[model samples]
Target: MPELGGPTSAPALLRPHDPAPPLLDAARLGVAAHRGLDVEALLTWTTDTADLLPLPGTGSTAALWSALASVAAADVGAARVLEPHLDALAVLAQAPTPVDLGAVGAGGSSTWGVFAAEGPGVRLEAHEVDGGWRLTGTKPWCSLAGTLSHALVTAWVSDDERRLFAVGLRADDVLPAAGPWVSRGLAQVVSAPVTFDDAPAVPVGPPGWYLRRPGFAWGGIGVAACWWGGAVGLARALWDALGAREADQLALAHLGAVDVALTAARACLVEAADQVDAGIDGKPSAVLARRVRTVVAGAVEEVQRRCAHALGPGPLTADEAFARRVADLGVYVRQHHAERDEAALGRDLLAAGVAPW
Candidate 1:
């Protein structure tokens, strides 16, 4: 396992005498203001060394563990480093039968994101064109838009139909919005709105295929794995803070609470991974994904709250690593969509009116 603040040159647990891992590469990431992460290195390590992408199911539980470990490491390592790759993995998951996973695995050289943030804000539209397809309009919340070479994007194909398109971000007429992102938390991630002018694209799947796929649900739950790992990182910090040193009963109690929360979250994540690997046909996968995401999100919040209460402002303010973990987790978990997702899941379950066990 890679040590928190970037991997140690040598294994620290086995050889305590070994030098500590190098501190995160600040220069590669960026300076103080709006830090840009050195995502390439992180992606490279995950691809070549960890070999975590294209998540070949059944025989590949290693990918799940590796994904969780990397996310936790990212929380300690770069804070905003894992999102793009996660997006890419989700893309690879739903890719068409003819699509090549070989090129995509090594295409860590070419960073990717799932640019599907559509709303009153910025909605991309796809049109059938002379050769392949063309996408127009704008995509918001495009993480690493300026840097991502490829993206699995969603665009409106018709009033009632939306399709997924595999696009080259560097293609002509696509523009990354500037000056909109203004947050220190997950600031290493460069998310911005983008404008497109009929950029050429290749359709990944047919209309409505993106949201209809089991991978869509799996991707939703996979996010919870990262959140679970992040909470574990915070819980470990609490453990380290207590150590053998004397602490008040309240602090110890809070640590206990954090421990329980993280343990439960991990179990849910593992079970969800198994279901995802085994493939539950139809809405059962979606149901499990929603249930697990909801459970893990709540656990993450509990861990965050308990850690803050027990540890106080010192770690959140003074300790750079702990602060980043807390901050990034806060922002990243917003992918949960709070009540909106809950309402949708609840309404769907109500409509179905029976548990699919």
Candidate 2:
């Protein structure tokens, strides 16, 4: 709603017939990445949307719906950019010390990693200092790299005493190292290496709390929502192209397949949102988040296939926006972690076993 550079920079409550809130800001973030504006503007854009978070607090379906809309307008890059900020907000909402949610609600991003076991692995170490705590270590896959003013970092205390810490990145000691992400899709959302050189920090939760928290699964499902949005965005190409040109029987078949898969995907999201909200009564939430992600990812992949099959390489190569959208969504939905997540789902599935009709 502030003067972001792409999509609908003009603010409004909602699009004419759309159920989504004002989500056009994602377009601005997407174009900001494409335009090579750096992460500073991205930070600024994310910080401006204070009202976007659920008012009563975090964990609301409203937040998920809003994120879905945001992702739909731009792509998953925009969703990925804002997701961690929401993750931190959710963390703070349930934190021991009440952070000024209004103040910290502004822009920033951080990512927990796919790091290796011991060795020179990316780990943050915490020390009990006079003032508070200080962190020193390398954190890999630090998205938004040097641009964000703050980040919720994961660090180790002693042994496997891993904890999440809120650290100020604007401080002099912390160093965000430039590293190559080397992916065509999310190249704009940089995931460089960062080092905290005795930077002052505060513990977000007790040891191992980051993983134990319900917000972890909640945030994961939110990413699924982005993938769901991306599926919608990518499928739009099919909708428009198919409508404009006369479709043969095969083309109609492809369109029909896309519709069915997307219907299932959308239903998954709506059902998942209800599940997430229902789980707020201290129950474990959304065993189906990974399942939902897999469903949406499959739907997105199917849509990509059907769109390409129906329309061929002409529109893909010819329409820059369409091509870019397809590529971007392809890379972004991979946050699903493929079968690794599927394995987790399998374990849960086995634990729950089969249901009898």
Residue 269, model 2, lDDT: 69
Best by the TM-score measure: 1
Instruction: Give the Å error, residue 348, model 1.
Output: 2.2
lDDT of 2 by residue, 1-357 (tens): 111223333321122343444434555545534543345555455555534556212335644554544444454566567666666666667676654423333333433222212325567688879857788888877777576667777778888678777777766788887667787776777777887798887677788877767666666766766676666665666777777878889988987887888778767766666666666422235366677788878888898888888888897778876777777788777767788878887777677667412
List residue ranges in candidate 1 displaced over 4 A: 1-36, 43-56, 61-66, 73-80, 83-90, 100-108, 355-357
| Model 2 clash tally, residue pairs | 1
lDDT of 1: 0.65
List TM-scores for all candidates, in order.
0.82, 0.81
lDDT of 1 by residue, 1-357 (tens): 223233211211212332222222333223211222455555454344224343524434335444444445345334344544555565665566555433323354655678777767667899987656888999888877786677888899888788887777775688887647786667767688888898877777678877887677776676676677677777777777887479899987997787677677667766666666787646877777788888889988998999889888989879987887787788888888788878878877887888655
Candidate 2: list runs displaced more than 4 Å.
1-38, 55-63, 100-120, 280-286, 352-357
Q: Which lDDT value does model 1 have at 77?
A: 35
